[model samples]
Target: MKISIITVCYNSATTIEKTILSVASQTYVNIEYIIVDGNSKDNTLEILKKHENKISKWISEPDKGLYDAMNKGVAMATGDLIGILNSDDTFHSNTVIEDIVNFHKKNDIEASVGNIVQHRENGKIVRLYSSKYWTPEKLTIGFMPPHPSIFFKAALFNKFGNYDLGFKIGADYELITRFFLRNKIVWEYSGITTTAMLVGGLSSSGTSSYKLITKEIQKALAMNGIAFSSFKIKMRFFWKIIGFLKK
Candidate 1:
Protein backbone atom coordinates (compact mmCIF):
# COMPACT_ATOMS: atom_id res chain seq x y z
CA MET A 1 0.00 0.00 0.00
CA LYS A 2 1.10 3.53 -0.70
CA ILE A 3 2.18 5.47 2.41
CA SER A 4 2.38 9.20 2.98
CA ILE A 5 4.71 10.70 5.57
CA ILE A 6 4.15 14.24 6.80
CA THR A 7 6.75 16.43 8.53
CA VAL A 8 5.51 19.58 10.21
CA CYS A 9 8.22 22.11 10.98
CA TYR A 10 8.88 25.73 11.96
CA ASN A 11 12.37 27.26 12.00
CA SER A 12 13.94 23.81 12.11
CA ALA A 13 16.82 24.65 9.83
CA THR A 14 19.38 22.96 12.04
CA THR A 15 17.70 19.54 11.92
CA ILE A 16 15.08 19.31 9.18
CA GLU A 17 17.59 18.11 6.61
CA LYS A 18 18.11 14.88 8.50
CA THR A 19 14.35 14.40 8.77
CA ILE A 20 13.89 14.89 5.02
CA LEU A 21 16.81 12.62 4.17
CA SER A 22 15.38 9.89 6.40
CA VAL A 23 12.10 9.87 4.53
CA ALA A 24 13.77 10.15 1.15
CA SER A 25 16.02 7.20 1.97
CA GLN A 26 13.17 4.92 2.97
CA THR A 27 13.47 1.47 1.38
CA TYR A 28 9.79 1.53 0.57
CA VAL A 29 9.38 3.08 -2.86
CA ASN A 30 5.69 3.95 -2.65
CA ILE A 31 6.23 6.74 -0.16
CA GLU A 32 4.88 10.26 -0.43
CA TYR A 33 6.76 12.86 1.64
CA ILE A 34 4.96 16.08 2.48
CA ILE A 35 6.10 18.99 4.66
CA VAL A 36 4.21 21.93 6.12
CA ASP A 37 6.38 24.77 7.36
CA GLY A 38 5.19 27.68 9.45
CA ASN A 39 6.91 30.34 7.34
CA SER A 40 10.20 29.92 9.04
CA LYS A 41 12.58 32.86 8.98
CA ASP A 42 15.52 30.54 8.73
CA ASN A 43 17.40 28.35 6.26
CA THR A 44 14.79 25.62 6.66
CA LEU A 45 13.06 26.59 3.45
CA GLU A 46 16.38 26.69 1.61
CA ILE A 47 17.19 23.14 2.66
CA LEU A 48 13.71 22.06 1.68
CA LYS A 49 14.29 23.65 -1.69
CA LYS A 50 17.53 21.72 -2.04
CA HIS A 51 15.63 18.45 -1.51
CA GLU A 52 12.46 19.51 -3.27
CA ASN A 53 12.72 16.69 -5.78
CA LYS A 54 12.21 14.08 -3.07
CA ILE A 55 9.27 15.90 -1.50
CA SER A 56 5.92 15.00 -3.03
CA LYS A 57 4.34 18.21 -1.83
CA TRP A 58 5.26 21.06 0.59
CA ILE A 59 3.95 24.43 1.70
CA SER A 60 5.27 27.32 3.78
CA GLU A 61 2.89 29.59 5.70
CA PRO A 62 1.98 30.75 9.18
CA ASP A 63 0.09 28.24 11.29
CA LYS A 64 -1.53 28.20 14.70
CA GLY A 65 0.99 25.67 15.99
CA LEU A 66 2.47 22.22 15.46
CA TYR A 67 -0.82 20.29 15.32
CA ASP A 68 -2.30 22.88 12.99
CA ALA A 69 0.51 22.29 10.54
CA MET A 70 -0.05 18.54 10.95
CA ASN A 71 -3.72 18.91 10.12
CA LYS A 72 -2.84 20.87 7.01
CA GLY A 73 -0.40 18.18 5.97
CA VAL A 74 -3.02 15.52 6.59
CA ALA A 75 -5.48 17.33 4.37
CA MET A 76 -2.85 17.29 1.61
CA ALA A 77 -2.01 13.60 2.03
CA THR A 78 -3.36 11.34 -0.74
CA GLY A 79 -1.91 7.97 0.20
CA ASP A 80 -3.56 4.87 1.64
CA LEU A 81 -1.54 5.10 4.88
CA ILE A 82 -0.39 8.23 6.70
CA GLY A 83 2.39 8.82 9.23
CA ILE A 84 3.82 11.93 10.84
CA LEU A 85 7.51 12.39 11.50
CA ASN A 86 8.54 15.59 13.22
CA SER A 87 11.31 17.81 11.86
CA ASP A 88 13.46 16.96 14.87
CA ASP A 89 13.04 13.22 14.40
CA THR A 90 14.43 10.59 12.02
CA PHE A 91 13.58 7.02 11.18
CA HIS A 92 15.72 4.67 13.24
CA SER A 93 16.68 2.82 10.08
CA ASN A 94 16.06 2.83 6.34
CA THR A 95 13.74 -0.16 6.78
CA VAL A 96 11.41 1.67 9.18
CA ILE A 97 8.83 2.44 6.51
CA GLU A 98 9.26 -1.04 5.05
CA ASP A 99 8.47 -2.55 8.44
CA ILE A 100 5.43 -0.31 8.83
CA VAL A 101 4.10 -1.47 5.45
CA ASN A 102 4.66 -5.17 6.11
CA PHE A 103 3.03 -4.93 9.55
CA HIS A 104 -0.21 -3.67 8.06
CA LYS A 105 -0.16 -6.11 5.14
CA LYS A 106 0.33 -9.09 7.44
CA ASN A 107 -2.43 -8.02 9.81
CA ASP A 108 -5.90 -7.04 8.69
CA ILE A 109 -5.69 -3.74 10.50
CA GLU A 110 -5.92 -0.11 9.47
CA ALA A 111 -3.13 1.21 11.72
CA SER A 112 0.27 0.06 13.02
CA VAL A 113 2.29 1.23 16.01
CA GLY A 114 5.94 0.68 16.88
CA ASN A 115 8.56 1.87 19.37
CA ILE A 116 10.88 4.89 19.63
CA VAL A 117 14.32 5.68 21.03
CA GLN A 118 14.78 9.22 22.26
CA HIS A 119 18.42 10.30 21.90
CA ARG A 120 20.77 13.23 22.20
CA GLU A 121 23.22 14.84 19.75
CA ASN A 122 26.07 12.47 20.69
CA GLY A 123 23.72 9.62 19.76
CA LYS A 124 23.42 8.52 23.37
CA ILE A 125 20.17 6.68 23.99
CA VAL A 126 17.97 8.44 26.52
CA ARG A 127 14.65 6.67 26.91
CA LEU A 128 13.09 3.86 24.93
CA TYR A 129 9.34 4.26 24.43
CA SER A 130 7.62 1.03 23.50
CA SER A 131 4.28 0.43 21.86
CA LYS A 132 3.87 -2.85 23.73
CA TYR A 133 1.21 -3.31 26.42
CA TRP A 134 -0.65 -0.22 25.38
CA THR A 135 -4.35 -0.28 26.27
CA PRO A 136 -6.74 2.61 26.02
CA GLU A 137 -7.11 2.44 29.79
CA LYS A 138 -3.35 2.73 30.22
CA LEU A 139 -3.79 6.27 28.96
CA THR A 140 -5.27 7.05 32.35
CA ILE A 141 -1.75 6.64 33.72
CA GLY A 142 -0.22 8.95 31.10
CA PHE A 143 1.43 6.25 28.98
CA MET A 144 1.05 6.66 25.25
CA PRO A 145 2.38 5.00 22.14
CA PRO A 146 5.25 7.03 20.67
CA HIS A 147 3.67 9.53 18.30
CA PRO A 148 6.44 9.24 15.70
CA SER A 149 6.04 5.47 15.54
CA ILE A 150 2.37 5.49 14.58
CA PHE A 151 1.09 4.99 11.05
CA PHE A 152 -2.64 5.33 10.50
CA LYS A 153 -4.89 4.44 7.59
CA ALA A 154 -5.89 7.63 5.80
CA ALA A 155 -9.57 6.96 6.37
CA LEU A 156 -9.20 7.01 10.18
CA PHE A 157 -9.25 10.76 9.82
CA ASN A 158 -12.62 10.65 8.11
CA LYS A 159 -14.08 8.32 10.72
CA PHE A 160 -12.50 9.44 13.97
CA GLY A 161 -11.55 12.93 12.81
CA ASN A 162 -8.24 14.84 12.78
CA TYR A 163 -6.10 16.16 15.62
CA ASP A 164 -7.94 18.69 17.74
CA LEU A 165 -6.23 22.03 17.30
CA GLY A 166 -7.93 22.77 20.58
CA PHE A 167 -5.12 20.89 22.30
CA LYS A 168 -1.85 22.76 22.50
CA ILE A 169 0.65 20.00 23.21
CA GLY A 170 -1.53 16.98 23.89
CA ALA A 171 -3.21 16.46 20.53
CA ASP A 172 -1.40 13.20 19.91
CA TYR A 173 -2.39 11.93 23.33
CA GLU A 174 -5.96 13.04 22.79
CA LEU A 175 -6.05 11.49 19.33
CA ILE A 176 -4.79 8.13 20.61
CA THR A 177 -7.29 8.21 23.46
CA ARG A 178 -10.12 8.91 21.06
CA PHE A 179 -8.98 6.30 18.55
CA PHE A 180 -8.35 3.39 20.90
CA LEU A 181 -10.69 4.22 23.79
CA ARG A 182 -13.66 6.03 22.34
CA ASN A 183 -13.72 4.79 18.74
CA LYS A 184 -12.19 1.32 19.28
CA ILE A 185 -10.12 1.15 16.09
CA VAL A 186 -8.21 -2.02 15.16
CA TRP A 187 -4.42 -1.58 15.30
CA GLU A 188 -1.30 -3.68 15.64
CA TYR A 189 1.89 -3.14 17.61
CA SER A 190 5.52 -4.07 16.92
CA GLY A 191 8.46 -4.17 19.28
CA ILE A 192 10.90 -2.60 16.85
CA THR A 193 11.98 1.03 17.34
CA THR A 194 10.91 2.92 14.22
CA THR A 195 12.05 6.44 15.02
CA ALA A 196 14.85 8.25 16.83
CA MET A 197 13.29 11.38 18.23
CA LEU A 198 15.79 14.10 19.05
CA VAL A 199 15.59 15.57 22.51
CA GLY A 200 13.96 18.98 23.33
CA GLY A 201 10.88 18.64 21.17
CA LEU A 202 7.44 20.04 21.99
CA SER A 203 6.50 18.19 25.18
CA SER A 204 9.95 17.84 26.75
CA SER A 205 11.02 21.43 26.28
CA GLY A 206 10.68 22.40 29.94
CA THR A 207 8.98 21.74 33.25
CA SER A 208 6.20 24.23 32.54
CA SER A 209 5.53 22.78 29.09
CA TYR A 210 5.46 19.26 30.51
CA LYS A 211 2.96 20.35 33.13
CA LEU A 212 0.78 21.90 30.46
CA ILE A 213 0.78 18.65 28.50
CA THR A 214 -0.17 16.66 31.60
CA LYS A 215 -3.06 18.96 32.28
CA GLU A 216 -4.12 18.65 28.65
CA ILE A 217 -3.88 14.88 28.83
CA GLN A 218 -6.11 14.87 31.88
CA LYS A 219 -8.60 17.07 30.09
CA ALA A 220 -8.42 14.87 27.01
CA LEU A 221 -9.12 11.75 29.06
CA ALA A 222 -12.20 13.32 30.59
CA MET A 223 -13.39 14.58 27.21
CA ASN A 224 -13.23 11.01 25.94
CA GLY A 225 -15.46 9.81 28.77
CA ILE A 226 -12.59 8.44 30.83
CA ALA A 227 -12.52 9.42 34.48
CA PHE A 228 -9.23 11.11 35.34
CA SER A 229 -8.24 13.59 38.02
CA SER A 230 -5.47 16.16 38.42
CA PHE A 231 -3.80 13.74 40.81
CA LYS A 232 -3.54 11.28 37.96
CA ILE A 233 -2.04 14.07 35.92
CA LYS A 234 0.59 14.71 38.59
CA MET A 235 1.46 11.04 38.49
CA ARG A 236 2.97 11.67 35.05
CA PHE A 237 5.96 13.39 36.68
CA PHE A 238 6.62 10.32 38.78
CA TRP A 239 6.54 8.07 35.72
CA LYS A 240 8.69 10.50 33.75
CA ILE A 241 11.30 10.57 36.48
CA ILE A 242 11.38 6.78 36.46
CA GLY A 243 11.85 6.71 32.70
CA PHE A 244 14.70 9.19 33.02
CA LEU A 245 16.37 7.18 35.75
CA LYS A 246 16.22 4.03 33.65
CA LYS A 247 18.08 5.83 30.90
Candidate 2:
Protein backbone atom coordinates (compact mmCIF):
# COMPACT_ATOMS: atom_id res chain seq x y z
CA MET A 1 0.00 0.00 0.00
CA LYS A 2 1.23 3.47 -0.81
CA ILE A 3 1.55 5.93 2.08
CA SER A 4 2.04 9.69 2.08
CA ILE A 5 3.85 11.43 4.95
CA ILE A 6 3.54 15.20 5.38
CA THR A 7 5.85 17.38 7.43
CA VAL A 8 4.80 20.97 8.09
CA CYS A 9 7.62 23.29 9.11
CA TYR A 10 8.62 26.92 9.66
CA ASN A 11 12.22 27.93 10.35
CA SER A 12 13.04 24.48 11.65
CA ALA A 13 16.68 24.64 10.65
CA THR A 14 17.99 23.01 13.82
CA THR A 15 15.91 19.84 13.53
CA ILE A 16 14.35 19.37 10.08
CA GLU A 17 17.31 17.47 8.58
CA LYS A 18 16.88 14.65 11.10
CA THR A 19 13.19 14.61 10.23
CA ILE A 20 13.97 14.39 6.51
CA LEU A 21 16.62 11.75 6.98
CA SER A 22 14.25 9.72 9.15
CA VAL A 23 11.66 9.64 6.39
CA ALA A 24 14.32 8.95 3.77
CA SER A 25 15.60 6.01 5.79
CA GLN A 26 12.21 4.33 6.04
CA THR A 27 12.20 0.62 5.24
CA TYR A 28 9.04 1.05 3.16
CA VAL A 29 9.96 2.22 -0.32
CA ASN A 30 6.47 3.01 -1.59
CA ILE A 31 6.18 6.22 0.42
CA GLU A 32 5.57 9.77 -0.63
CA TYR A 33 7.19 12.40 1.60
CA ILE A 34 5.81 15.89 1.17
CA ILE A 35 6.89 19.01 3.03
CA VAL A 36 5.10 22.35 3.31
CA ASP A 37 7.34 25.15 4.50
CA GLY A 38 6.10 28.49 5.73
CA ASN A 39 8.67 30.48 3.80
CA SER A 40 11.41 29.65 6.24
CA LYS A 41 14.00 32.42 6.54
CA ASP A 42 16.71 30.04 7.67
CA ASN A 43 18.85 27.27 6.25
CA THR A 44 15.78 25.00 6.18
CA LEU A 45 15.34 25.57 2.46
CA GLU A 46 19.00 24.79 1.86
CA ILE A 47 18.57 21.51 3.73
CA LEU A 48 15.48 20.70 1.71
CA LYS A 49 17.47 21.30 -1.45
CA LYS A 50 20.35 19.24 -0.11
CA HIS A 51 18.10 16.19 0.23
CA GLU A 52 15.84 16.96 -2.72
CA ASN A 53 16.16 13.48 -4.14
CA LYS A 54 14.94 11.81 -0.96
CA ILE A 55 11.82 13.96 -0.75
CA SER A 56 8.99 13.22 -3.15
CA LYS A 57 7.71 16.81 -3.21
CA TRP A 58 8.10 20.06 -1.26
CA ILE A 59 6.95 23.66 -1.36
CA SER A 60 8.38 26.64 0.49
CA GLU A 61 5.65 29.24 0.66
CA PRO A 62 3.83 31.32 3.20
CA ASP A 63 0.83 29.49 4.62
CA LYS A 64 -2.01 30.32 7.00
CA GLY A 65 -0.48 28.18 9.71
CA LEU A 66 0.58 24.64 10.50
CA TYR A 67 -2.85 23.25 9.68
CA ASP A 68 -2.90 25.22 6.48
CA ALA A 69 0.39 23.69 5.42
CA MET A 70 -0.93 20.27 6.42
CA ASN A 71 -4.04 20.80 4.31
CA LYS A 72 -1.81 21.69 1.40
CA GLY A 73 0.19 18.53 1.89
CA VAL A 74 -3.01 16.52 2.07
CA ALA A 75 -4.22 18.07 -1.15
CA MET A 76 -0.97 17.07 -2.82
CA ALA A 77 -0.99 13.54 -1.42
CA THR A 78 -1.90 10.67 -3.77
CA GLY A 79 -1.12 7.79 -1.44
CA ASP A 80 -3.73 5.46 -0.01
CA LEU A 81 -2.79 6.36 3.57
CA ILE A 82 -1.88 9.86 4.80
CA GLY A 83 0.11 10.83 7.90
CA ILE A 84 1.73 13.97 9.33
CA LEU A 85 5.18 14.01 10.91
CA ASN A 86 6.30 17.32 12.31
CA SER A 87 9.61 18.90 11.30
CA ASP A 88 10.85 18.48 14.87
CA ASP A 89 9.99 14.80 15.00
CA THR A 90 11.24 11.57 13.41
CA PHE A 91 9.94 8.08 12.85
CA HIS A 92 10.62 5.82 15.81
CA SER A 93 12.32 3.32 13.52
CA ASN A 94 12.89 2.61 9.85
CA THR A 95 10.21 -0.10 9.94
CA VAL A 96 7.48 2.15 11.33
CA ILE A 97 5.78 2.63 7.97
CA GLU A 98 6.40 -0.98 6.99
CA ASP A 99 4.63 -2.14 10.12
CA ILE A 100 1.63 0.08 9.41
CA VAL A 101 1.38 -1.33 5.90
CA ASN A 102 1.58 -4.91 7.19
CA PHE A 103 -1.18 -4.24 9.69
CA HIS A 104 -3.53 -2.84 7.06
CA LYS A 105 -2.75 -5.54 4.50
CA LYS A 106 -5.24 -7.71 6.37
CA ASN A 107 -8.12 -5.24 6.48
CA ASP A 108 -9.34 -1.95 5.07
CA ILE A 109 -8.99 0.19 8.14
CA GLU A 110 -10.07 3.78 7.75
CA ALA A 111 -7.56 5.06 10.32
CA SER A 112 -4.63 3.41 12.05
CA VAL A 113 -3.45 4.81 15.39
CA GLY A 114 -0.21 3.93 17.14
CA ASN A 115 2.07 5.02 19.97
CA ILE A 116 4.70 7.79 20.26
CA VAL A 117 7.64 8.58 22.45
CA GLN A 118 8.02 12.25 23.36
CA HIS A 119 11.51 13.29 24.37
CA ARG A 120 13.71 16.28 25.12
CA GLU A 121 16.10 17.87 22.63
CA ASN A 122 18.85 16.07 24.48
CA GLY A 123 17.25 12.75 23.51
CA LYS A 124 16.07 12.01 27.01
CA ILE A 125 12.90 9.94 26.93
CA VAL A 126 9.94 11.82 28.36
CA ARG A 127 6.99 9.47 28.14
CA LEU A 128 5.15 7.05 25.91
CA TYR A 129 1.83 8.20 24.48
CA SER A 130 -0.14 5.08 23.67
CA SER A 131 -3.47 4.62 21.92
CA LYS A 132 -4.06 1.39 23.81
CA TYR A 133 -6.55 3.11 26.13
CA TRP A 134 -8.05 5.60 23.70
CA THR A 135 -11.72 5.28 22.76
CA PRO A 136 -14.13 7.33 20.72
CA GLU A 137 -16.01 8.10 23.91
CA LYS A 138 -12.92 9.84 25.29
CA LEU A 139 -13.54 12.74 22.97
CA THR A 140 -16.06 13.99 25.50
CA ILE A 141 -13.08 14.63 27.78
CA GLY A 142 -10.80 16.01 25.06
CA PHE A 143 -8.54 12.95 24.78
CA MET A 144 -7.37 11.99 21.31
CA PRO A 145 -5.07 9.57 19.58
CA PRO A 146 -1.55 10.94 19.27
CA HIS A 147 -1.64 13.12 16.15
CA PRO A 148 1.75 12.08 14.75
CA SER A 149 1.00 8.40 15.24
CA ILE A 150 -2.21 8.53 13.20
CA PHE A 151 -2.46 7.49 9.55
CA PHE A 152 -5.79 8.11 7.88
CA LYS A 153 -7.06 6.65 4.65
CA ALA A 154 -6.70 9.49 2.17
CA ALA A 155 -10.38 9.18 1.40
CA LEU A 156 -11.25 10.17 4.95
CA PHE A 157 -10.26 13.73 4.11
CA ASN A 158 -12.41 13.65 0.96
CA LYS A 159 -15.43 12.43 2.89
CA PHE A 160 -15.14 13.88 6.39
CA GLY A 161 -13.09 16.97 5.44
CA ASN A 162 -9.69 18.47 6.26
CA TYR A 163 -8.43 20.23 9.38
CA ASP A 164 -10.77 23.00 10.42
CA LEU A 165 -9.01 26.28 9.82
CA GLY A 166 -11.27 27.94 12.34
CA PHE A 167 -9.20 26.41 15.11
CA LYS A 168 -5.82 27.68 16.21
CA ILE A 169 -4.67 24.84 18.46
CA GLY A 170 -7.39 22.23 18.58
CA ALA A 171 -7.89 21.27 14.94
CA ASP A 172 -6.44 17.81 15.37
CA TYR A 173 -8.64 17.24 18.41
CA GLU A 174 -11.61 18.55 16.46
CA LEU A 175 -10.79 16.35 13.48
CA ILE A 176 -10.40 13.21 15.55
CA THR A 177 -13.61 13.95 17.42
CA ARG A 178 -15.42 14.47 14.15
CA PHE A 179 -13.98 11.32 12.56
CA PHE A 180 -14.35 8.82 15.39
CA LEU A 181 -17.46 10.07 17.16
CA ARG A 182 -19.39 12.16 14.67
CA ASN A 183 -18.69 10.07 11.59
CA LYS A 184 -17.97 6.80 13.38
CA ILE A 185 -14.96 6.01 11.21
CA VAL A 186 -13.47 2.53 11.59
CA TRP A 187 -10.04 2.65 13.29
CA GLU A 188 -7.49 0.37 14.92
CA TYR A 189 -4.55 0.42 17.27
CA SER A 190 -1.35 -0.50 15.42
CA GLY A 191 0.67 -1.21 18.59
CA ILE A 192 3.72 0.37 16.98
CA THR A 193 5.78 3.35 18.08
CA THR A 194 5.23 5.53 15.03
CA THR A 195 7.03 8.82 15.82
CA ALA A 196 9.66 10.05 18.21
CA MET A 197 8.13 13.44 18.93
CA LEU A 198 10.17 16.30 20.32
CA VAL A 199 8.93 17.75 23.61
CA GLY A 200 8.20 21.29 22.41
CA GLY A 201 5.90 21.56 19.43
CA LEU A 202 2.79 23.48 18.48
CA SER A 203 0.70 21.92 21.24
CA SER A 204 3.38 21.73 23.93
CA SER A 205 4.22 25.24 24.92
CA GLY A 206 3.59 26.56 28.42
CA THR A 207 0.84 27.13 31.00
CA SER A 208 -0.79 29.95 29.07
CA SER A 209 -0.83 27.86 25.95
CA TYR A 210 -2.22 24.96 27.91
CA LYS A 211 -5.11 27.06 29.12
CA LEU A 212 -5.65 28.38 25.60
CA ILE A 213 -5.74 24.86 24.17
CA THR A 214 -8.16 23.74 26.85
CA LYS A 215 -10.54 26.51 25.90
CA GLU A 216 -10.05 25.63 22.26
CA ILE A 217 -10.79 22.01 23.06
CA GLN A 218 -14.07 23.04 24.59
CA LYS A 219 -14.85 25.12 21.56
CA ALA A 220 -13.97 22.20 19.26
CA LEU A 221 -16.33 19.80 21.05
CA ALA A 222 -19.11 22.33 21.13
CA MET A 223 -18.70 23.02 17.43
CA ASN A 224 -19.15 19.33 16.71
CA GLY A 225 -22.27 19.29 18.92
CA ILE A 226 -20.46 17.00 21.32
CA ALA A 227 -21.39 17.61 24.94
CA PHE A 228 -18.35 18.73 26.91
CA SER A 229 -17.56 21.11 29.74
CA SER A 230 -14.52 23.04 30.95
CA PHE A 231 -14.19 20.56 33.78
CA LYS A 232 -13.96 17.67 31.35
CA ILE A 233 -11.36 19.51 29.33
CA LYS A 234 -9.42 20.16 32.51
CA MET A 235 -9.60 16.47 33.27
CA ARG A 236 -7.53 15.93 30.14
CA PHE A 237 -4.53 17.44 31.94
CA PHE A 238 -4.91 14.95 34.75
CA TRP A 239 -4.78 12.14 32.25
CA LYS A 240 -1.72 13.72 30.64
CA ILE A 241 0.02 13.75 33.99
CA ILE A 242 -0.78 10.07 34.37
CA GLY A 243 0.59 9.43 30.91
CA PHE A 244 3.83 11.18 31.79
CA LEU A 245 4.21 9.14 34.95
CA LYS A 246 3.71 5.85 33.11
CA LYS A 247 7.33 5.36 32.02
Candidate 1 residue pairs that clash: none
lDDT against the true structure, per candidate, is 0.89, 0.91
Residue range 8-75, candidate 2, lDDT tens digits: 99999999999999999999999999999999999999999999999999999999998899999999
Off by over 4 Å in 1: 239-247
Model 1, 149-223: lDDT tens per residue?
Answer: 889999999888899989989999999999988888898886668899888877879879978988889889989
Q: What TM-score against the true fold does each predicted structure earn?
A: 0.94, 0.96
Best by TM-score: 2
Query: Model 2: which ten-residue window has the lowest total lDDT?
Result: 238-247
Candidate 2 accuracy as TM-score: 0.96
